[model samples]
Target: MVSSFRHHRRGFFSTLLLLLAVAGCATFVSNISVDVIRHPSNPSSSLPAFHEAPAFRNGDECSSSSATGRVDIVMTLDANYLRGTMAAILSILQHTSCPKSVTFHFLAARPEPEVLANICTAFPYLDF
Candidate 1:
């Protein structure tokens, strides 16, 4: 129908606008430090296996925390799906101008130490 086509067109434009905005921010990335990682991948405890990904540095245009606010991402956590989340986080940080300014919050229905510990093994920065 014509109405369905109109809705799809609007959705396409909205997505295109968002992608352009993100790309614009990416262009402002001035310094990229690849040597050091934010959180060390090695977890002390015997946790599930996970490899560490490289960290992303903030662009010069990014404001200091004393001035700018942070972005928090919330996601539900579990064992199975947790294995595949590193790439998604990496992609978000890679596309953003302020990588360190972003924090991830994982909500678990019934929190478990092993699951939490496993997350630590993967992304040791926060209490996931």
Candidate 2:
């Protein structure tokens, strides 16, 4: 029984040492800074123009409404994910029957004027 107790004590100490070593290693992570490249706004004229989407009407009761009758879509925009954001916007416009009625609300971690300009240039008709 004494031998067994000694072996158990040794195992416990080994595990404790291993845990402390791992904890120390984990705490020594270096801080990293990333630089993002800001892109200039592309000319809106270069982009393909899309025709206005037809107005939607409810089955029960509805009348003709303008593009101001919109569906709001909120999204986050950043320079790192600009391409992905543009693709998502394109997909939304393609799939939505009432593209003109769709509005986008972009939120950013930082104030990026270039990002806003790029989005505007890409989607000239976007109401955000």
Candidate 3:
């Protein structure tokens, strides 16, 4: 009976390990799928890039120092990275400070640059 009990324990652990291995594989595959946004045929294709520009009030210089508010800088990325990156950015933003009104700009690249630029520019402070 003791030997049979030991065998049962070993089998249970083996099954548990198998399930863990499968779970680990699924996680790895999910991450790989997220990192692959562009086609493998053309890695040279450039996605629209975003930049932060200083916001200015009317009659204020483009590089004005009159702007006074907390600048909430949110660097948007592909939705795939959104979950993890958002958490990280939020943590940093919680501790960081800036002197301009905070805003969020989502950047993406479809088939045209103009469309992407338009979307990015629609935000109060977005540069593409």
Candidate 4:
């Protein structure tokens, strides 16, 4: 019984030491510093390029009944930021009593299918 207990204790302690060593190595590797390149204008540069949202001509079908009309503004902003902005606009629209118009323009240098789809999903009224 004593020998068995001693053997089990040695095994348990060896396993524990191995685990601690692995943990320490992992910590050391994770703590190693990495340099990241950052530009002074990175924040502004990350923003998608801007262009004016085109105006739609009023047609016979476009009577003022539309709750809100959307125009694709040209920009490189991602869906996450776009969603946040839309949420804010939506909140304001919900709180306001007066007839308010909420519009989103995708101001981008180039057309982005994913971004457009994202915007459309967020705002059903988005007009491409």
TM-score of each: 0.53, 0.49, 0.31, 0.31
Candidate 1 global lDDT: 0.68
Per-model C-alpha RMSD: 15.7, 9.9, 9.9, 12.9
Per-residue error (Å), model 4, residue 50: 24
CA lDDT of each prediction against the hidden true structure = 0.68, 0.67, 0.49, 0.50
Better of 1 and 4 by lDDT: 1
Model 4 deviation from native, Cα RMSD in Å: 12.9
lDDT of 3 by residue, 36-127 (tens): 74332234544322233335323332234435543545455553443444445444434434323335555554344443443444334432
- Residue 75, candidate 1: Cα error in Å is 0.6
What is the C-alpha local distance difference test score of candidate 2?
A: 0.67
**Candidate 3 vs. true structure, TM-score:** 0.31
Worst 10 residues of 4 by lDDT: 33-42
Q: Write the residue-wise lDDT of candidate 4 on 4-117 in tens digits.
A: 999999999999999999999988766663212222223544323222222324544443655545333334455447545555545544543431233444466566666565
Candidate 2 per-residue lDDT over residues 1-128, each given as its tens digit = 99999999999999999999988776664212121222233544322223333333233232247554568999999877876788788888877666666778999999988767767766766778
Checking candidate 3 for backbone clashes, the offending pairs are: 70-100, 71-100, 72-102
Candidate 1 per-residue lDDT over residues 22-110, each given as its tens digit: 98777655323322223334456333465755656789988887346688898777755654565577678779998888888888788
